[model samples]
Target: MPGPDDVSIRNLTQSPVPYKVLAFYKFADLDDCETLRPELAQFCCGRKIRGTFILAPEGINGTVAGTPDAIDALLDYLYGGAFGTRLAGAEAKVSWSETMPFLRMKVRIKPEIVTLRAPEANPARQVGTYVEPEDWNALIGAGDVTLIDTRNDYEAAIGTFEGAIDPQTKNFTEFKDYVATHLDPAKQKKVAMFCTGGIRCEKASSYLLAQGFEEVFHLKGGILKYLEVTPEAESRFNGECFVFDERVAVTHGLAQGEARLCRACRNPMPSTRACGAIG
Candidate 1:
């Protein structure tokens, strides 16, 4: 069997593909997220879409899957602002599967979309420079660069860049403590961080910049985009990338991997950390 890293685009296409899985986020001021929530949920339900969405004053974040036409319709509704607030700059990372990844649809209004808890860490204000997938390897490979993984502890256990530092945070709210205690601005100047998708790192990069970090960079479109675009031969990511869905994980080709959810944590664990080992 070819290893996970050996995945090629050949295996990426699903037979009779019927669902389009979209992962997207945007940091903007949405004064009416409360008003928009119900209508958005109703629209998704009407379109037979399934997944979760977090709408906040800061912006929106979610990963939902539906048929191609349905997905496009949802995008149109969002960008067109049928709910009265347009997400014109929303960027989506798309993939296809044979079935809907989520069992139901949910749209909730929250205080912060991704929840870093620091009011100053506003992605709408500033963020790190974007390092394209093609150029990521060179940037992180440089000795002066400090590569960091902004995801929680379990996500990093499944996969990460070769030299990245895991903050070991069990939840995103703990990230502020990790940054204040573990990082040094004067010593680690050129920082590059990433997450499962772009949301966490989008806010994280903004936080680091607010803390006086000299230079910060983030993976554009996050890991999914990297796996989708970077050929395996040129890819630096190792193991399967955990995803928030029934598929559990995906590999270098953006093809689903052999991961399953741990009932205790309700999070995807690698096959090596199967049910017997999960706690």
Candidate 2:
């Protein structure tokens, strides 16, 4: 199987795209987060890359955008340099945009990379079983499995797999309550969950296991990976996958989709709508 960097390069070179956005996350223990933040920020700053990176004692998570060479250099440092010692299972989801998606680079110390606010939610220690993209359809299609989208409400409003249940959450912090009220362990024997890049679901799956839910699973690389490998004809996804950048969303093959962000509410808008005039 191709590595994350290989996948990113393939997607970037396939078209005449100039800018590349690399979104990735990892769960690991970092005893030197205080020392690592500035070094990482300085590296990005010197290279003129723009994006946000959040570091915590638990791990690192964020997205960065720049030239293909610049991104490759960063990944080399991350996977083979000094920082590599403390990282594990790091994966990047690559997509293209006409313009730079972020204004500047930011590296900050946070309580958690993708905050669930649940003390028991520790992905570094434990997470749900990972279901590969190719096998995802059959797993979710199982009669006893409950499919759940672990993303925010705005994200799910634009696209999701058919038959997947949206928890209607405004943010990840509310996910615990949604699970508590909406999901019954007794009735839902096996649970399957997913998020944009897999970080949120990693934390969520861990939380569910802590809550005593049996047989929990999450999409290995979330929707982005699914879209990359699954052909449009075989795709169970109903619409474009909402993204955090200016591109708004992406469809099968990582192609930029038609949806744009509403300027006022930051919600997704159809291609025909005047996104700038929405405010």
Candidate 3:
């Protein structure tokens, strides 16, 4: 079986096909995953769409790519009360490429759409502070703001905002440790945090607040939404944004095909290869 990297490369080499990706959520009100799993699985299976959709009490978070017509058909099905109108305005971001992107489709039920190890997370009660990109640009430059990359170190290495501090963590759990040990006590209220999809920051911001940070802010949709609004040419994010999709990384400002190989594996990474590793 092909690894994730192989699948991404195979897809990328193909001819351009119109495709779109949508990610959204609503406050948890019911057994969302249980309610939506079968229907969503059936929808994706019948259409032969290849990607992953995560359902939880929080809501649904997914990234799927396929032919424009098939994708549109699936969207109509979803919007037509299939997943119910409560998930309305689940707008898809458009991108075209010559790749299959995803090798399979999976719909999983989980406690949270984006896991943060918060066993008692209440999405409805505690949402993170949402900051727009324009505001982020200025805030990042502000001397007082201590910008934190909430994503794993690998993701941040390729592309991140200028002056953003690396947590240097292997994963989110380490992030909490980093915050407790390294984050300056004086920089509490002045800190700004971010993550790949904003989900981590959402939870992390709340955690930070609980840890006594007076003020906290998160990138609204994380890096993806930021790139959508900020334009490709002027982004401070140096390379492709590593997405949980077939593309691996979306070329932010760097040249296409320059940043997708993993340094350790030497396999195709989206941006900077970390440490050269044997494949």
Model 2 misplaced regions, further than 4 Å: 1-14, 272-279
- What does the lDDT read for residue 71 in candidate 2? 81
What is each predicted model's overall lDDT from 0 to 1? Answer: 0.83, 0.84, 0.65
- Give candidate 1's total backbone clashes: 0
- By lDDT, the better pick of 1 and 3 is 1
- Give the winner by lDDT: 2 or 3: 2
Candidate 2, residue 278: Cα displacement in angstroms equals: 6.3
Candidate 3 segments whose C-alpha is farther than 4 A from its true place? 1-16, 25-27, 76-82, 88-92, 184-186, 253-257, 263-274
Clashing pairs in 2: none
TM-score of 1: 0.91
TM-score of each: 0.91, 0.92, 0.80
Candidate 3 structure quality by residue, lDDT tens digits, 1-279: 222222222333333445545443444454656767888888788877878887876666777877766666666666554455555544234455466778888988877776667654444566557898767887777887888888887788677888888888876867667876887556555778887666677778777766667777888767876776687666776555777655667664211235565546533454333555654
Candidate 1 lDDT over 1-279, as tens digits, reads: 221221222234554689988887778788888788988999999989999999988888999999877876777677665544446556577788877789999999989999888988988889889888899999999999989999988888888999999989999999999989988899887999998878888899999999999699999889999999999989889988999888888998688988878887677677776655544
After aligning candidate 1 to the native by TM-score, how far in Å is the CA of 157 from where it should be? 0.6
Model 1 stretches astray by more than 4 angstroms: 1-15, 83-85, 273-279
Which has the better lDDT: candidate 1, or candidate 2?
2
